[model samples]
Target: MITSKLMRPLTTGGVLASTVLFASGCKSMIVFDPKGPIGEQQRDLIYFTMLLCLIILVPVLLIAAWIVWRYRDRKNNRAPYQPVWSHSTKLEIVWWGIPIVIIVVLAVVTARYTYALDPAKPIESDKKPVTIQVTSLDWKWLFQYPEQGIATVNYLAIPERTPIKFELTSDGPMNGFWVPQLGGMIYTMSGMATTMYLQADEPGNYMGTGANFTGRDFAKMGFTAKALPQKDFDRWVADAKASGNALTEEGYQTLAKPGTTDRMTFASIPSGLFERIVHDYSMSRGAPPGYTLRAVTLSEEKKAEHTAHPKNGQLPPGNGAQKDAPDAQSLGQPDHRSGHMHLIHGK
Candidate 1:
């Protein structure tokens, strides 16, 4: 070994190694081997925005460096203190106007791609888009294909290049939906709905998980998005339907329970289950039984009549009805009735 007095070589080698290791850990720095159109757009958006940002950033950095170097203090530390010259109309215009233009360009580009990737818009190809209703539960995803009449947990299968429309909502409030390679994240809240559209270009399994932290096992709230050939996807659906365990309303109540590490499957789904889930029927059903009774508003005149004459329509104060004079006294007590008595009492 060559004799080295200074640790400069070893220190420099260690620094270089650390830099390489850290850079390797960044997912973006890795090459894009996209398996979907959504993935391609995501990667392109990253690079395009990065380049646009650098156009302004790099020049500002260079000017800062040049100014620092040129005005650096020397033994002759004479420098002009021109505090009043700090506000330059031209410089201000350049800074503000350039950023505005950049933002406009970015916004236009983003909107174009976003609409192109809209899930509600069906592709014009021969392939019909897969419709999946996704319900986010405490720690799992429930995917129901109404057309296929089948349901699955922790797995979803779609054909490559075929668009998918996911109608998403939560079993409860503690969840968010995301598939990093597919599209942006959306919230999944009870009594509310959100949608996401995506199309994969290759046949493979991609990992996706809930991006929001809910509770324990949030890390495990993941599902496998499988892009299969059309034939394979059809087969999967057929198999699911043939499995025989139908997901009924009662079955869904069990599936929607809280706590974690739960999973369930359905050979087929009961008719109208998907519609019910999407239309917030569960929330409606969960309402108190008597709450369903309509409360008809009484007009001021009607209210006055009801107050003056009081009967079955009026609010009950003491109890039901007094049959006779002695019953009105109730063997001893005077019923406090003036307001409601006329309505309840006949004639």
Candidate 2:
């Protein structure tokens, strides 16, 4: 009667706990519901690690329960009592050897997966990968499709079953780009470019967001990644072109300003826009200047002379260097070497 009473509450508690866990498991988790090859690989790694851990966890738990039940302070119990026992060579070896073997296996699997799933590594696909330039803005994401000659803000569209090569940078503070169902996160830093490759096996809309804490609006820094069939993707590009929105230099300047913005699309974009953005950010550390491109082929002698004596700590100028060139700093323009100048009022 006493044992039955004690077991009743434990049985009820176990059932309650199982019910709660079952209910929680019904919810969909993106990591488990992967839609792409990269995500599947990551999910497999997670499951593999969990199963390996359970190999030790289950045996230890079972042994602990058996010891508690068989050695409990019961009137008729006859379990062995080794109060003075120091150690057992077999037990020690079993415990240590099992864990070491598990570790070795895990390490090998982890290393293999790490190399196979490197973000920068290209996906194995016969189709040519689509290159997308990603720029993390103050509170939004800008994607430029150079091949398609179009751009979109806070929305990325790609063709299903095709590899995507993402070249990422940031115009605002440092941020992380992540598409949970597609692949892992990659950092986007200003003045430096990073690359990641991802793909979707089927048509669907996945949520992409900035995984790093950026600013006040970081929570809202999200975008939609839509994967569609080839025909649909081409139609999207055509529709974007018909929208008549052009991402011009002046327009981008305004759009690049710090603030949140709704989804936007451009039908056309200036050629070499992505390169210019990267170059401008790298060179000026501010907005891109309307500087004229003047290529000068310098002879070896001229190069040596320029290297020996840099003009105003600047690289040797080509023939186009004016004798009385205006000082960019004095003119309140961005200094090529010193970066942008911030003017203080009433100083």
Candidate 3:
């Protein structure tokens, strides 16, 4: 009867655990389902560290359990008790020595992997790595293929078995760029560029997104990374060129607006666009051209009007001359007197 009762609860618990595991499907676990060389290395490191920790954890847990059971107070009090006992040199040495050795091993392994997995570190390959410039917008991702002379919004394409070097920056706010099945996450910051290297060993589609919580629409910031064979990738590039959609300065500004956007492809982009973007944010430039100038001018105008007409206390008329102001149809053209244009490079 006792054996049967014990078996009933054990069977029920085992069934429940299995059901839970079944409900959480393996497909949802991307870390364990890595598809790239970088991800495989990262997964291996995780497993190594976990195994090292378990080596210590299991014994400590077992010892605690044994001590609790054997030293439990009972009527017979057979367990040895020495109230005056202070310390054991052997026990101290064993505990301290083991942890010190584990720390030394962990430190060595960590340092080795840290340098080996650096995103900027080049991977050994016969074929040259492809470079892609990535810009994180308010709620979207923009990918510029400088070598291919094409760009895409919220979509990325790479050739399989080839290293891809990604240069990341943010046009809106700081965020994390991550493709969990391909590699580790890296931060994208304004006024700076970061690098990450990744390569897919097989042809497949992987999910990528901004891992950091940036803004209200952050949840919608995601993109698809498709890895294809060299031939297929070339075909896709040809198709993108046939699409005949060119990315211009004005179009980029519009796309950078804070909102969700669908995936899009561009046939061509202006030369040195990525370089200009970095230069605009660099310390030498100090601030984005036209951004601070307009704000300062507007503030000075408001202040001057208030000071000149203290009794009226009214703001000045817009831009001081309505006749010279460009019409709505000619909005992009520069206003001669103000020397200001709404669009960058008058695009």
Candidate 4:
């Protein structure tokens, strides 16, 4: 049937459309942009590692294929059956020494670059590195500039090609901080700090997001990282500081609640905002665990009377006749006149 013949092409067309749509939806697939020295070093490291791996892999793979085709049983008509011969010093040395050399080379190269790119290190620049404190909350990101006294949610803007250092922490669960074109992803946890460096070489807007899995709105937990000229960035900051209401301690307490979606910016940032977020005082209160000891002592204090005698009334406070020696008479027969009883009473 013509319908049946058309179905195959139609199905293929649908599959192709879906694949293109999926890839298009994820547009920020670009890895590293060599804006700053740090990003350049990271890109270099990746390229070098890949190139070195291919060097050893390509030769080994080609040699394997050549041996299989040249020594096939069909070409020889009769393959020799011989006793095992294991000892080959040259081949064994080549295989073992090659891998060892590769590992040593990789280790030395990676270690040197890793220390150089340490976030705490001071990179040489004509101007000072801008400081930004980032806090990850449940389903939202808070960016605060202690120096500028401004705050923004889900958006960060800095001068292009200027070194920017981020001191990152979290108020809620853990999250990953990533700006794909700028650099790699790092983690943020409550009460702990992590740092990352990035600079936009090209003056443009880049997308950044949390690479870690969070709750419902995790997919939308992203923002725009804008790189602008110094003058333009300053103007933007000034305009933001003048437009909206000042964010105070009370304002932050209200915003600290979970489930903030998309982006919001605060015109005025509260003083000591970062410190308060780190040492959260608004946690729910409860009786300390050491209260159990107090409970036991109070229970003992509340008891009014304690009985000592089982056959009759409570015994007196002291022993009227103390026995200096063990009594042999009570071993065989019941002693009804035992006067060595004591009573404890709490009132």
Q: What is the TM-score of each candidate against the true structure?
A: 0.69, 0.75, 0.76, 0.71
Candidate 4 residues lying further than 4 Å off, grouped into runs, are 1-29, 73-86, 281-347
**Runs in model 3 with CA error above 4 Å?**
1-28, 73-84, 283-347
Off by over 4 Å in 1: 1-33, 75-93, 280-347
Writing each residue's lDDT as its tens digit, candidate 1 over 60-171 gives 9999999998877787767777666466899889989999999999999989887876655555566677888888887788888888778888777888889888888877
Q: Which digits, one per residue and each the tens of the lDDT, describe model 3 over residues 42-120?
A: 9888888888898899999999999998867888767576678689999999999998898889889988999999998
Encode model 2's per-residue lDDT on 82-132: one tens digit a residue.
Answer: 688587999899999999999999999999999999999999999999999
Pick by lDDT: 3 or 4, better one: 3
Instruction: Give lDDT tens digits, candidate 4, residues 60-137.
Output: 999999999876778447757775878999999998999899989999999999898777676677878898999887
Candidate lDDT values, in order: 0.70, 0.85, 0.84, 0.74
Q: Is candidate 1 or candidate 3 better by lDDT?
A: 3
Tell me the number of clashing residue pairs for each predicted model: 6, 0, 0, 0
Model 4 weakest lDDT span, ten residues long: 292-301
Error of 2 at 118 (Å): 1.5
Q: Pick the candidate with the highest lDDT.
A: 2
Model 4 quality (TM-score): 0.71
Better of 3 and 4 by TM-score: 3
Off by over 4 Å in 2: 1-27, 72-82, 286-347
